[model samples]
Target: MKNMDVMLLSTSCIQSQLMKELLSESLGPSITLVNQHTFAYHDWNKPALILVDLANLPTSNQPWELYLRGFKDNISTVLLNTQDSISAQKLLQWPNVYGYFSHYEDQETLIRGLTKVLKGEHWIPRSMLIEMLLYLQSIKPITTTSIELTSREIDVLNLLSNGKSNTEIANELFVSEHTIKSHLYKAFKKINVKNRVQAKRWARCHLPLYDG
Candidate 1:
């Protein structure tokens, strides 16, 4: 595992430096630590695990998403400083995101989680994982005939399946929240699904954008 790169992305210079030192001292020479800017000038040919400090992200730009998107599918990600499980779950919709470290976690816990993640295992909290499993269990497969969706409804459902909230979707589409709800209601009717999770499962099965 010598020279394995683990990049830490945090907008706060102080936080990035402190975390780099802490992680380097803790994990030893087997892991190479990179700051947010180091990877830009270098070609990362091997699969790397990215540690993103979500709490320090710029509220306006969301540059982290763009940075993560630049990586190949082999890139694994673990979100750090997550405030709550709901937001963490939503963020996990990204295919590369494997797990998260809560804001309240101590250094020992953080190190333990990172070690597990390095071993190609998820380090999510047990409670959060249970909640997620319950939600997934509730999403029953729905069989429907040929369904016709308006362009706007398709757009709404796509964002919804990507774990976007109604407000976020409305802002992205530049429409009112009420209008987004109307679109969702119509889409739900068309898809013959009742709620967001079911709709998301249906989209994963049927929608070309997210179809596996």
Candidate 2:
């Protein structure tokens, strides 16, 4: 019943205009649109949806990661790209990215993806989905014993798997710096790991890091 507020981030002017037109035509005029080259993660006014063209954006190691960490539970994200520009291997690892639609896809597919995303469903390409399943199947299962971890410890492991440092993880989770170190220490002990890198490897083997 309520209108959706959407933010569009793209380096291509044409792609931005096309998305605006398609969204307006499909979702009606009540939807609000904000076009920007870049956005700060701590902006007060959060949008309901964010559409980002990953290929067009400048090469940063973790731009999407930073954005996803900032708006993890609050906003839905759509990653737009050409099929050649993005690979299925990388796409499956983005937990917060709600969908991936090709720029060359038909208008109907794009509209359907947006609608599905708005309705709280993930929209992945069929081919990409198959590739993801295959990749999952190809990975050899770890035969290590199960370890008991507290919820907080799991959270710490998840952040560590994403290549976040203690300070960054602490800042993102709103915990004191000392508390983060404490959690990490306990997590390493529980998982029988010597360091953060080992913990990350263990997590990737056992946990569904990107299926949240």
Candidate 3:
């Protein structure tokens, strides 16, 4: 985060100002303040870090809509005062999110988390990380002794489990994306999984012995 600007976007004047002071103390001249409404008019480059105060934003247009409205995927993002809400855990997994500030954390902790994110490290609560791991670990193995899979189907599942997009899998397997999708749809039906994320969990939990 050295020699880079950090942008703060929020609707609340008080919240934005308070955060500005806190961040300025640690970040010094690298912090720039911008209101939510004036962002489109600003002629600034994409910042090194985009810190968002989600609490002050309006929620009428779907919950995470405000947060994602002007976010840049190239920049690291940190949510302000996320606390322990059930939905916060889900938000943590979104792309470009480097960390979050829990409502329960002290101001000093917020600075530390920001510094960690600036240094290219993700800062997340240990409990949430463990919970996510346990959830993935708990994907019940599908009873599939009666089912059969083609070699291509196994290739699709293996690649999908490794986080390859359908297009990437298709490119790797020398097939069209449509063919990959067809394979995935059939694989989903056979394994009783609904989506790629679920399929990945199932593969991780059950596919160790699979030589695919």
Q: What is the C-alpha lDDT of each candidate?
A: 0.68, 0.66, 0.66
Q: Give the better candidate number (1 or 3) by lDDT.
A: 1
lDDT by residue (45-69, candidate 1, tens digit) is: 7767778777766532233353444
Give candidate 3 misplaced runs (Cα > 4 Å). Answer: 41-47, 60-72, 133-212
TM-score of each: 0.57, 0.59, 0.53
Pull out the clashing pairs in model 1.
none
Scanning candidate 3 in windows of ten residues, the lowest lDDT window is 61-70
**Whose lDDT is greatest here?**
1
Query: Model 1 TM-score?
Result: 0.57
lDDT of 3 by residue, 1-212 (tens): 66556778677587678778778888555577776666445544545576777677654223233334324354567788664764442553344677777667787788887878777788877876787667556644434685566656766786787677988776656569999899999988887898888988877776532323
lDDT score, candidate 3: 0.66
Better of 1 and 2 by TM-score: 2
The deviation in Å at residue 184 for candidate 2 is 1.9
